[model samples]
Target: MTAGAIAAEPLGVACPMDLGWRYASGAAMERFLAGLRERRIEALRCDGCGRRYLPPRPLCGDCRLPLDRWVPVAAAGTLEAWSVYRLPILDGRTGEPRPTPYGIGLVRLDGADTTINHLLAETDPGRLRIGLRVRAVWREELRGALDDILHFEVAR
Candidate 1:
């Protein structure tokens, strides 16, 4: 059979899949998450560019240098960019649809050079702005995860 005939044939196979899996948060991220459990924020600082990464990474994106310096970051940050979503979206953590009319933003936390995208507590477009100050709203029970911060609210 010619290659064209083979390509036209249906390629179907029966197989079972296991959707469950485990993810290993590396040393940098592990340390970052540990800080969250303690209600503290930390970032990895790159010596070359002097840029601090919120979700501490092994290497700097710009300098490509191994990041080993740890620095404290404020829970409060500036809303650099934002959008208000009117439709319900699936929450990855809970696997449920989040209530409609929610806000999300790229926040540049104090002491960090990069921005971290997170859910915003404010849904009002008129109230949201680029330079608006926001602070993390932590869950009553602290968990060593990004979701430990329920959301960020406008810092009054």
Candidate 2:
């Protein structure tokens, strides 16, 4: 090395990391899922529009008012919309890649005006329809997560 020569600097630092979040799901959602832990469901009612929402929100968009009124909703709801996932997605709870060929749907449970999006047990497109009646299937052990209801099955 030459006595007066300057040393070359390393370009950049390589620090790969796994990112995560720590949060409170909030009061409204906390109460709503707590209901799920007991196989119960509730929705926030819009006083003006009279719309009941599953997975209750703090305010009603249509009514533009605070939603504090709680209303009981049925476990069974009509299949408003659905789709079969051909790709694998990571499961939020397990932090694992969920298997492909799964089903997801939007359900407007009885007594609720808004639809709740969730998993459907029937993956076969032929067996699922827009107006199909489906019921929630609860897990044997309830953990208060939305997936506590494993999936909706075609109601008998």
Candidate 3:
């Protein structure tokens, strides 16, 4: 086939995307992710709203106020709500969404005012429920990111 003909031919194409993001000058984010690496959770408190934010940020989303206070939260928390997803979507780190039958849960930490969205290790449909107490399972090494904690599991 000529160059023009080849270009016109029906060819399956897949365009990959980079989902990862690097926060420019994110001192607060650095600390937050570092805490997770150490199996510790951290949050930033908004001086104005008095709301503690998990995955600490320099600014409060609600009031758009600058947050400078740092608070350490517990690794253990309660499951505020959850749902089992059967459809695969893009994983945060990997561009490809993982296989189905995974549990995505909203976790309210012991000291935070908001819930964080994370993966749940236990996927038993019967065992999963609202108000379920869960705890963070940290990785063997500290990587300074949310992935440091592999997933939350039903607290024994």
Q: Per-residue error at 77 for model 3, in Å?
A: 0.9
Q: Specify the highest-lDDT model's number.
A: 1
Task: Please give the ranking of all candidate structures by lDDT, highest first, separated by commas.
Answer: 1, 2, 3
Model 1 per-residue lDDT at 94: 69
Lowest-sum lDDT 10-residue window in model 2:
1-10
Off by over 4 Å in 1: 1-18, 92-95
Clashing pairs in 1: none
**What's the lDDT for all of these models?**
0.91, 0.89, 0.83
6-50 in candidate 2: lDDT tens per residue? Answer: 677747988755678898889999999899899989999999889
lDDT string, candidate 3, 61-88, tens digits? 8899888898878888899999888887
Q: For candidate 1, write residues 1-156 as lDDT tens digits.
A: 557634566778987443666999999899999899999999999999999988888999888999999999999999999999888877765678978888999999998989989999999999999999999999999989998998899999
lDDT of candidate 2 vs native? 0.89
Best-performing candidate as measured by TM-score: 1
